[model samples]
Target: MEPDDMLQTVDSVSFDRLVLEDSGRMAVEFMSYGCGYCRTIEPIVQRVASMIAAEETVLRVNIAADPELAKRYEITGTPTFVMFLNGSEVGRTEGPAPTQSAVIDAITRPFMS
Candidate 1:
């Protein structure tokens, strides 16, 4: 399918199935539908998510839709980007990175080691 379609929101059973069970590097975006920053960075996030390795899964979680999940992640605002490795958070970015390069820089920084 298309690159944009690769980024999906994981919630409840889906989150457990895709991220917890798989046990690998994962990228998750926590966002809200009404947030301006979330809307602005979506395209850049999508493109970066697509270009990443197949073994790495890109996920999005809507805070409004899933408040419990949001609380669990400690997401206090919109457009929070988190990188998971072996089912644990290894990196995170709060607020809009604005550019693709910044997003990539945040997401891949942990893996550089």
Candidate 2:
């Protein structure tokens, strides 16, 4: 599926359902409209998500749009990445990811077990 189709908006209420009940792997990209780093990493996130199969999903949450989620996660900056497996956060990275390989590595590392 396309990255656009794979992306989901995560909020306080829907967060549990999207990350937990499904028990599916997810990559959450936390970003803001005004963040240059977020914009720069957007395409890399999309490409990595697209390269992955249907079983895995990459979700984009706008910190500007969802301040509640940002506060909940203690997100102080843009371009933060969180990987979830079975509804719990497994790994996270802050700032520009640099490349799709770094994203792919973060997303799949926990599953390597």
Candidate No. with top lDDT:
1
| Per-candidate total of colliding backbone pairs | 0, 1
lDDT per residue for candidate 1 within 1-113, as digits (tens), equals: 33547677787657767776668888788888799988898888888887885756678888888888888888888888788888777878788568989887767777667
* Each prediction's TM-score versus the true structure: 0.87, 0.83
- Candidates in order: C-alpha RMSD to true structure: 2.2, 2.6
How do the residues 11-105 of candidate 2 rate in per-residue lDDT, one tens digit apiece? 76787788767688887888886988876877777777778867688887888878888887888887887778887888777874668787788
Best by TM-score: 1
* Model 1, CA-based lDDT: 0.79
- Any idea what lDDT model 2 has? 0.77
